[model samples]
Target: MDIIPQIRAAMHTLLSTTTEAIAAAQQYVKRPDRAKFTPSTLVQTLVYGWLAQPTATVEQLAQMACRIGVDVSPQAIDQRFTLATADLLRQLVLASIQPVIAANPVALPILQRFASVRVHDSTSIGLPDALTSTWRGCGNATTGGGSTLKCGVQLDVLTGTITALVPTITGWN
Candidate 1:
């Protein structure tokens, strides 16, 4: 079956999320020097353009904007997303889109009605390089190296979606 609809839906979702991120980020006025661009629209355009075809580029994004009559330049797009922190936007991409694109395991409807509850626990991703820092290091394990705290996240499993997730970050090494 064609996956165009699914991809289109995902693109819309990404656009909406990116828009919301910009709106939220705009409220934080703690920084005065931050240059302003249409954060929401720019991000939405980027994600939409990225999803629209097999080959998407910054130039293509600008073209898409032109097609939609948004009047954006390639440099403007870069300045909006790259020069700006847009940390909130990036965080949402990592936290939402990445996970959605990954293993979005959900409980079967038939299984959902069962009394049995699903459970998920902590998971870790170790870097190949040793983590040697001033504040943190590998734990006192002889094999793994110095006593750097283990890293990972604690996530809960649910029938329809992730109920909760707590990031497990090791302190500075």
Candidate 2:
């Protein structure tokens, strides 16, 4: 099966076609009503930028945005690292992977001994000080105050399914 076309079509639908869906997914109370940084543009910039360079800087991401037809400064990109943007990105990720389903099953005596094999992992992401109100972090003399978001996930390997995507926990303070 040629999956290249399928990948292209999926990307097109996610990044450019479904305008209303993107807007609805990114809805936040304080989100400014402006065209400068649409949800799709932000999603494209981060997704492709990180894929191109895993450890990309804000300037690099801004350049990626430019390549995708949006002109903005690195500071503008930096300012976009907010709670709302995080939520939007999370929602997009869930939406993107929700359709995936493993077709073939692996044959293994040890694996078949159990009903399902589950894996769990968690990580914490530091955020700007402005987000302290939403995601409080450890306070120290050097940084005064900060914020972070703790994300955790659980996947069942037997059927290739994600059982949990918990992002409610805040930083350990």
Candidate 3:
């Protein structure tokens, strides 16, 4: 199987979901009355936009929206950032994460010697004191309260595929 078609199929699977299903699942849009940007479009815009440029600005994302056949302003896109949007994006990311198994694996003698080569790593990120209630962290001397989150990923080097993603919130003692 060609990798291009496989990738296209994966993308289509991710973006082909109905807006009604996403709205009901994520509760993103309550009333779709005369709404120009649907939940699907929003997710599509962000997914493709960020995939094209991970550090894309709101204006660039708006351009991506235009490419996807929606005309939304940068400010309009910026205003859409809320708790609901955050939750929706988070859920979409978690749902879209699947192991990528290529038909042709990497051609490396050392890597091929093993049946499978897996790697794992994790990182902890500090959060603002205001979010301590939600994501408690080990106390800090400066603010006396802090929050942190640990994120980890497992990957198969030979297949160049991500196997798992884990996110854990730290709690204060």
Worst 10 residues of 3 by lDDT: 96-105
Give the winner by TM-score: 2 or 3.
3
Q: Runs in model 1 with CA error above 4 Å?
A: 1-14, 25-37, 53-55, 83-86, 94-158, 164-173
Cα lDDT tens digits, model 2, 21-111, are 8567556424556667777788889989999999899999999999999999999999988767776766666565534423344566789
lDDT of each: 0.53, 0.72, 0.75
- Model 3: per-residue Cα lDDT over 63-147, one tens digit each: 9999999999999899888768866766655556662333345778978889788889998777776676665676655335577
TM-score of 1: 0.45
TM-scores, all candidates, are: 0.45, 0.61, 0.63
Error of 3 at 169 (Å): 5.3
Q: Global CA lDDT of candidate 2, please?
A: 0.72
Best by lDDT: 3
Q: What is the lDDT of residue 78 in candidate 3?
A: 93
lDDT, model 2, position 118: 83
